[model samples]
Target: MPAKRKLKLVITLIGLLVLGGGWLIVSAQNHPSSQPAQQTQAKSKPKYRTLTLDELHHDPTLTYCSIIYYTVKHGKIQRWQEVSKVSLGWQIEQYPTNDGFKVLVWPDMNIKKEAKQLQPNWFALTKNDSVTYHSFIIHSFRDDMTATTNLKTIVDQINHDHAAMKVRQMTPKMLIVKHKNSAN
Candidate 1:
């Protein structure tokens, strides 16, 4: 039994040495510092931005947050597709929410598509006095954003566009737009 054990240990050591030698050869051939051989060989990347939905909120002059709820038509409620709502947690990331999900936040609500609760008129907001934000029509934007903006950019843009919007806001659904300052 001891002889058999010794023979097995020897075989294992030999196997390990062979593997190590093979790895060293391969490592030399494929050096860690090797750069791309040609510019054409480089892979093109997917389209996306470094900014996350959270960073959009920190804009001091923020407008409002837009939460996009994705619906998958998969049968059997099989996660009905992956819903992406930027709720305030418990991001199992599946949706059809009732657990109270909050995806977007903004100082102003600018949406392209028509929404039921949205009101186009500017809020004469007062604390303790119900300034009911009945949803607003979400305007369409590029594919990059669910809506036109996350929140801060919307507010900043709104601040920039407020003057023009005042004239337009004479009627409902007319967005509050501010014209660019001449100095700028």
Candidate 2:
């Protein structure tokens, strides 16, 4: 073979090798299988963390007072309990008063009247005038069990903390009747 032709062939082979190597690097960078495991796992994690009662209260979106009921036991409430620093996503707001916690649950697309009925029960065990009832339909239960359980836990904590707390129980049936009658 001629020396000039041999040189041309060698140069072409070198150029092809360089182009193939560049293509492989670019393809590996774009493929997820070639990425580090940590990066892929991080992306799969949730963006929003579960908020606790304290965190939920400070949230800017919770504004409406959806429920307004007070427990009418024989004794007066001493003081309300403070929330912890833990993070959770129990989308509800609570305003503690001398009578009881005025719970304001967050808005939801699947809100039901039955869930609203569950609110007053958290304050009082039975049906009676002690558990007052006044709520609108703006906000409903995000997680009914979570909302009720948290409310009960907070109220219980507050009552437990106060030495002179007078907790009461009312009849659920009577309270429902009163609530319906008053709605007129």
Candidate 3:
């Protein structure tokens, strides 16, 4: 009888230990410790980067610009289409108001002559290709705007210009609607 009693006590103790071990495992999974959770969140974070307007304007490598032109009423429906892209020069200056750009352009002699004939006001002091010439298009925006937003405003002004025909005779204003540098 005593042996039987000892055996029952040992069995009950083993059963209790097994249940306690299982409960500990489940509790650990359901309620993770605060330190590890916070550590994991801290280890994984996000970063954002953007270019400033000044930096973008001064970039020499950004020498090319796509252009598009449109007329309000050429005695009929307004004819609009993309035109030849132009290459810019190293000289770039900010307007006195700090709201626009004066970029130097070295157009091919033929194009330059044609442009000179089209809009004499666009010509700077230099008429020949040896020196820098500024045929600037004005752009203005809030100081806090991003570079992309500034570019969008420039494009909008180019497209919406009522005197585009008078300025360049539909030689495509100084902005683009859709143009990809890639051939593909």
Top candidate when judged by lDDT against the true structure: 2
TM-score of each: 0.18, 0.34, 0.27
lDDT of 2 by residue, 9-75 (tens): 9999999999999999999999999999988988998343322335324422211111111222221
Tens digit per residue, CA lDDT, model 1, 1-184: 6999999999999999999999988987778455455532444543322333244334211111112111111112222122222222111111112222222222223433433243222221122212112123346432211122223333333334342233123223222333232210
**Which 10-residue window of candidate 2 scores lowest in summed lDDT?**
80-89
How well does candidate 3 score on lDDT at residue 69? 18
Q: What is the lDDT for 152 in model 2?
A: 36
Local error of candidate 3 at residue 181 (angstroms): 12
Worst 10 residues of 1 by lDDT: 66-75
User: For all the candidates, what are their Cα RMSDs to the real structure?
Assistant: 19.4, 15.2, 15.8
User: What value does the lDDT take at residue 107 in candidate 1?
Assistant: 24
Q: Residue-pair clashes per candidate, as listed?
A: 28, 13, 0
Off by over 4 Å in 1: 1-57, 60-63, 67-131, 135-184
| Pairs of residues clashing in candidate 3 | none
